[model samples]
Target: MTKKDKYQKVAYYPGCALEGTGHSYNRSTKAVGKALGLDLVEVENWNCCGAMEVKNVDPKLQTYLSSRVMSTAANEMDMDVVMAPCNGCYHNLKKAEYDLKHDPESVEVVSKLSQKAGHKTYEAGQVETIHALDWIKDTVGEEGLKERVKNSLNGIKVANYYGCMYTRPRHIFPEKDQGPGSESTSKPHFMDDLLAAAGAENVEFPLKTACCGGAHTLSDSDTSTKLVLNILKAAKLAGADVIATECPTCHSGLEMHQIRAEKVLGETVDIKILYFTQLLGVALGLKPRKVGVHENVSDSRGFLKERGLA
Candidate 1:
């Protein structure tokens, strides 16, 4: 089947952050999907997809955790595509797919763990994992989005921040950088493309894939704040009123540190951080409340309302 056909209805995996700190992202993503006529079947009995903790401690164990999610999607739900909104979850699942295919050790460990955990072992190629960007871009292209835009984000200037995990250590993502009409790891444009279709101005922000210091937030708050500040400052300088994000970790990092940089370092850069999905949801005529715009620490409800995007 064509990709357009495959992505119309797929398994949705929101990971842990979506349930907690990233609840707005979760709501916006679902709201956008519904508005676009896309179907998202939540994976049954899903588990964490490793994230930073398990991967730091044990790469193999992390593979097992990520694989478990895919196993449920493929074996139980009979799904062939797994869409993860969080970059961390999408990355871990993609990494698991790569590791299980190339590294026999990861395959063996995951197999044993799956059996011990009382689930079907996740064999390589059983399912495909994609980020929320790919899910929308592939299924509903920029043209599709333009036709669906009930509330155009015409006046909103945005800086698209992809963060590290989405494209770093790029060997795992064999689908990207495949020439024309494919996502570029070095300089990703999927988010830019989607927002532009919705009538938002995507600024030429250079720090698109730069690290947000998400991994070091607890261990090194100062570093995390500095990193986030740089992104915010750059976005503001680029003439962006908002910084659009796809990952929950990156979104929250920028939101929290935007305040932290002001309170602690007294270095404030006035800008708003919002999930790209939320922006799209609003453009598609979904209410600001429907997309949980108020849930974001860097509230954009009034900002969106001022422009009639709410």
Candidate 2:
């Protein structure tokens, strides 16, 4: 095993999607973090953040639900930075914290709501929330990551898809800015940094940060499929063999309805979709199955097998 300086163990908060449909992401997070010499301590009694859509249904309910996770990390765990790997969870948690801090009324309402739900109320900034990319870049620099690479994904081209949630609202804080404190653009490609940290070529697909029709899939499938097809089509046009994403919803939105997208496009765009953690694990010398490659709707095993690493 590679030995290095030990850092404080992080209390990893894997939200609903990660615990269920996004199981692969949770697995890859642990495997990649371990391989990178970081200790990921799972938060005890963690619960869902009610997702993005759920927030709109009942603001008080969503706020309390999200704060419940933070309260657990703060009261139970000793870690300071609560690492949320899911984009939706990151967004919701950050939004909850922001609301609980900036808007005092919302905090009171949420506190009452929490009492009703039998969960504890939390103050804003009680727990500093961060995304997975922030931890990956800060904890393991590019040089360290390169040294850990067992196999370079030389020929495989991936369209670095950031989607909307990864770079939106108030709380999207990646470790590195696009070009040194360049706040001119709100949208940043933090995941692309990780991709380059690995050895894959990141093609600038026109729709890299385009919306993947996110929770819209729940209400309108056809529109969601059309939106996802557009993103996938752009990836295919950019000569990418796979579309790599950080958000589980983005991955599922594009891959779950991929067959329909192929039918709509009138051509089979043979492209696989995967989470960034899965790719990171590969770069860290972990096996494909161990990183949850098999959970992907579009099998990327052949692509990995062709690379002489899978």
Candidate 3:
């Protein structure tokens, strides 16, 4: 089948970061998907879910707001699976769907809220929530990904970082979903597989799924420093040359604030962090800047140069 026929109607949810702070994420995901033969159809009228803070302040209100966004994909656009590239949006949308489906009171409250926002009705299973990483693993396949690897990540060790939100709330994630073959959440090892396919050595990181403190870095700086430091330390201990992650939040938290983390943690370690999509783009024979490798705080250019890819 042709590429258009393969993914005739895939919904791409850019979320808040994809447009602004996480703009690189949308670009990289779109580029990688296109290179690997998946035409990503982004949702046109999508909005933000306000991440954890909104849900924490008022669960009911947050659910209503999130439901409206999901309803847009379901009722208005008629999408089967809404591929959320951002972890925050993925979790928020998944949570709202679950609450509306399982709890009648929540459903009724959110229904009215949806109407207030000019929406018809929010239904359960309207749009199946999924992460881009999961979709890439399934549609692209290991062998297909292998074929796209033009340049191997030789002599470079990678540490896979999966922050919070990407994998939580047991309800949205199926038991089998956690497996390599399922479409449940963002699998860091999926990136590892792609890296390995490109002939790179993926360090078996013990703290691959560890939290990177996210926005908490702003409020609880000390605790956040420790969290970021530990993950970096884990990567260093495992002999990783660079840390790789899919979430932009994790990338910002760890990479953008490496200097601060070093001062707080009392050690200066040489490490760089890159988004998993950027790495995938490199493997797909795309230029580094096109995939957002330049946006990172660490000089990832050197990593690419050493490998003769720059």
Model 1: per-residue lDDT, tens digit, 68-187? Answer: 999999999999999999999999999999999999999999999999989999999999999999999999999999999999999889999999988978899999999999999999
**lDDT of each model, Cα atoms only?**
0.94, 0.78, 0.76
- Sort the predicted structures by lDDT, highest score first: 1, 2, 3
The regions of model 2 sitting more than 4 angstroms off are: 1-8, 116-119, 170-185, 263-267
Worst 10 residues of 3 by lDDT: 1-10
RMSD of each: 0.7, 3.4, 2.7
Model 3 residue runs over 4 Å out of place are 1-8, 175-180, 183-188, 263-266
Best candidate, TM-score:
1
- Candidate ordering by TM-score (highest first): 1, 3, 2
Compare candidates 1 and 3 on lDDT and give the better one: 1
lDDT of 2 by residue, 1-310 (tens): 1112223367788888887778898889888888877888888878778887677788767777888888888876755668898888887888788788778888888888778877667778778777787777766767778888887766778897877766675343433255763321245656777778788888877787688787887688788888887888889989998788888898888886687666765646678898888987887779999999998778888878888768
lDDT of 1: 0.94
Candidate scoring better on TM-score of 2 and 3 = 3
Q: Which of the two candidates, 1 or 3, achieves a greater TM-score against the reference? A: 1
Best by lDDT: 1
In model 1, the runs with Cα more than 4 Å from the true position are none
